[model samples]
Target: MRLSLLDRSRTRSGYPEADALHHSVERAAHAEALGYHRFWGAEHHAVPGIASGSPAVLLAAVGARTSRIRLGSGGVMLPHHQPLVVAEQFLMLEALHPSRVDLGLGRTLGFTEQVRRALRQQTDDVDTFASDLEELRSYLRREAPVTARPVTQTVPSLFQLATGEGLVTAARLGLPAVIGGPVLHSPELGEAVAAYRRDFRASAETPQPQIIISLDLYLAETEEQARELALSEAWAMARSRETGEFSPLEPVEQIREQHWSPRTTSRIEKSLHRMIGGPAGIVVPAVERLLEITRAEELMVSTSTYDRDALAQMDAAVADLLT
Candidate 1:
């Protein structure tokens, strides 16, 4: 039972990057010492809600700072970038980190079709996404059956990052994948696990099913404090449902400032059910419940604390669970 962290690069109510990066680098350094096995950062472009815009740059910097913990994208949405460019950049990263790098590919543009058009991609994007993923896989295998220009032979291992059917494809392709969704709820949990395991194909790259799942977190000193953090994440989750993905941490005061009809609050609770409370006594049990339900290979908890004080408390609670 390994416990890892996912840094979604939340803006923390518009915290300065100069400060956040300094804190993140220092925090990741501490995470390495604290025995966290892997630290996954994320990427977002044109989203003021998240600060994790340049995942590659951040990982490289974090890679330089620490030597042991594995690092990579919690996911780089495949539809947004050229597969060739991704292969080359990751190849370079592999040259630097070797076995320490992990690539999780999501099929999203990470936004809407309107934004997809904004990114200059076409309607055929999702249709071509799978093939593009295969191209990236073929390049990494360093053995494309055909002689193709723009081959990727640098990275030794590349894993697919997906949820739903993409998880099944990752199995068929025999790549390690992390299975999850923009949200985690419902009995779809068992089906998702079964889908990945049932259709697993033995390929030259991998012979067994390898998987991971995201745990929406709120570990803190007191249950009340935990609920407060959950409130912030819940707010983000509600916004994502309306706006497409997780937004920055809103000032709870500001959120309270808005007159939410009872309808909105009920809608949010129905969606983000698992993202409540702290680890003081409940963290381990919530995780155990998740594991009992999903039995994922790894657990990546998502936290939405506003500042270092909250992060430190959450980190310690998580550390206690790890020990």
Candidate 2:
């Protein structure tokens, strides 16, 4: 299978934001060296744990640090920005990087109500996501009634963050759908992928439908060690859902020392179990099962850990598995 990466640029509990940004660039270069297909950065706002607030800016930095590997947004939250501005930023990136940039658009709003207000975005914006996407495409293709700045080349690829609705929308627009790994585990996987394929309309850019599965993945010499590396982020996810603080990642050793209520413990365990990890013998089969079900053309792995070195090691191990 073709393997890729989506770096969240996670900031650990004691680390500064700069450290996380630097780690993202370092990870991108490392991913290139490891022969990963693409290195995507996510877009999150007002979140302490994630530093990728602007995917285009981070992608430009990553582009300067590496060559060959594709650079892109895991998704740019489409509802939060003007479609024209989004197109221009990515066009500029593509101008500098040539055919190596991707524009992955998503419809989600900000993480919190305060953030939504800060962005001057309303909940109603979600309804316009499809129209906004069409507007963005018009500018990219230079077919719109209006033009922003001059766009010299065509946008490399347009990707939609997959939902059942998103899968259908992507097909209608001739864009590839990037499905979360957890979505593939659902009983609805067959219908989702098949519908996308069957309903896809051929456009000048993409003649066929494509699906790429993005998963949280890690691998270590032992299953126990792999799970340990995954604990901090897993706990952070569970805790943030319960508390709404979205704090930075804590070390696994520190995490283990703390006690949780039964409900909290259950949340952590469920999140941890949902993650894809362990030695290759275990991960390989699970991945195969997913591919059999979803027929995804590529796998994009995302992992966030307290230790940068361990994260890189885990990345290398995943790369080795693909070979």
Candidate 3:
């Protein structure tokens, strides 16, 4: 089992966003030292809780700090930026880091109308996602419709962060993909992975179908402690859905002390159930089942916690299980 990590550089209550950003670079170096295969960062805009606004810049920081592990975006939302700018940013990353960069792309819009206006992005941008991806690919291959400078054949491996029709698009384009969250725990997973493999076409870059499952994972010595470790993020998720704003991760004790409505309680419980937690006995079997169903080539865990030390401990434990 190949194991990797997806760090969103989540901002916590008492810490500065700068710390979250620096922690991402530090975590990538730690992951490399721990023998993890890849370390992927995320891109989020207008989301105060997450500090990773630019995947290219964040990845450059990680790339400079780490040598062995593969570095890339969990995804850069394609709808938000120009294809050429995206290409140049990542190409510069590849140029600096050599063969260790991965260009993970996705089609997602801004979280709010205000954010949409800020990015000059609209919901209709999704309709052009496939065409946009092709344009980016063409630029990388030096076959663009318009001439561009810094012509080089060097390109990073492409991976799509997708589900449903997006998964099929990735297959048609012959790119590996990452999918998980609620879908991994649902019946739709088997069909989704199967369809991705069945409809896949080989391209010169990626010759075979490859799927990587990404999930929320929390592991601790006891189920109680593990659940506690997960509460901050779980509460944040519930609050974000119920309210318009996504707040920073709170302390476990603080979360427990809050008065929650039935709706928020249910949302928190649902978030908890979606995550894989507890001891090796519980977590290992769940991971095994996920692997059996998806038959994915790799697994990536997106973990959030207030305590960096506990997070690192959980990561090391999960890494041991993968071995």
Screening candidate 2 with a backbone cut-off below 3 angstroms (N, C-alpha, C), the clashing residue pairs are: none
Give the per-residue lDDT digits (tens) of candidate 2, residues 1-323. 78899998888878887889998999999999999999999999999889889999999999999989999998999988899999889989998898999999887789999998998987765388889999999998888888856565656588999875888889888898999856656788888888889999988888878889988777877778878888898888888988897878999889988888788788888877878788888889988888887788899998788888888888888898775
For every model shown, the clashing-pair count is 1, 0, 0
- RMSD (Cα, Å) for all candidates, in order, is 3.1, 1.4, 1.4
After superposing candidate 1 on the true structure, give the runs of residues whose Cα lies further than 4 Å from its correct spot. 17-20, 123-126, 145-156, 239-247
As for candidate 3, its clashing pairs are none
**Candidate 3's C-alpha lDDT?**
0.87
lDDT of 1 by residue, 1-323 (tens): 77677777667666674555566666677778878878887876666567666677788888899998888787777777877667767766777887787787777564566666777877654467678888877767665654334333445455677655677778778877775555246567777767777888877767888767776677767776666666666777676766576666776677778766576687567545666465446767776777776667787765656656667667766777755
For model 3, the superposed segments whose C-alpha errors exceed 4 Å read 124-126, 146-153
Q: Look at candidate 2 and tell me the lDDT of residue 198.
A: 93
The alpha-carbon deviation from the true structure for residue 269 of candidate 2, after best TM-score superposition, in angstroms, is: 1.0
lDDT of 3 at 271: 88
lDDT of 1: 0.70
Candidate 3: tens digits of C-alpha lDDT, residues 106-130: 8777888899889997666438889
Each model's TM-score? 0.87, 0.96, 0.97
Pitting candidate 1 against candidate 3, the one with the higher TM-score is 3
